[model samples]
Target: MTYATPPRRTLTALTMTTLLAGGLLLGQTAAAPDASAAGGKKVVCEVDKMRQQSHSLRARAARLQRLGATAEARKARAQADALDRRVRACVDADGNAPKPWN
Candidate 1:
C-alpha cells in the first residue's frame, strides 16, 4: 500500500488559490457608507472627513519638510490643498461659506 504527497509547487498553488478566493469574498461583503442612507447629510459628513484628512496631511507635510524630504513634503501639501478646495466647495454649496483654517 502506498500514498503520494502533492509536490511543493502544487501545494503552493492550492494555498494561493484558496487565499485569493477568500480575499474576493471578503471584498464583495465589505460595507461602505451610503449617501442615500445618511438622511441628506452625506455631503456634510464628507466635507468634515475631508477637513480632517487635509489637516493630517498638512501636518505630515510639515514634519516631512523638517525632516528634509522636500519632494515628499510637496506631494503631501499638494494633496492637502486639493482636499481643502473640495471642502470649501462643499461648504459653499451648503450655503455656509467656509472660513480659513486657523
Candidate 2:
C-alpha cells in the first residue's frame, strides 16, 4: 500500500499554524524588557487605574447606603469589593493586596 501525500491546502494550513504558534511563544517568552518592564510593572500602573475605578464604584455604593436601601447597598458594596480585590491583585502581580484595599 502506498501512503497518500497530504493535500496542498492542509500542508499550507499546518505551516501557517506552526508559524503562528511559534510567533506567539516567542512573543511571550522573549518579550521586550522596556515594554513589560520587569514582572509586569506596566500592568501595575493599569492596576492602579482599575483600583481607582473600583473606588468610584464603592463611592456610588456608599451613596446608595446613605439613601437607606441597605440590601441594594450591600450588593453594590460586595461587587465593588470584588473588583477592588482583583485590582489589588493586578497591582501586586503575585496575588498580594495593597494597603487600605477597603
lDDT values for all models: 0.85, 0.77
Candidate 1 lDDT, 1-102, residue by residue in tens: 754556877888899999999999888778644547346554444877889999999999999999999999999999999999988787777776566782
The estimated TM-scores of all candidates read: 0.49, 0.43
Off by over 4 Å in 1: 1-45, 96-102
Q: Over the stretch 18-101, how does candidate 2's per-residue lDDT look in tens digits? A: 999999999987874654556665433466667777788788889988999888888888888888887666656654645575
- Best by TM-score, which number? 1
**Prediction 1 global C-alpha lDDT:** 0.85
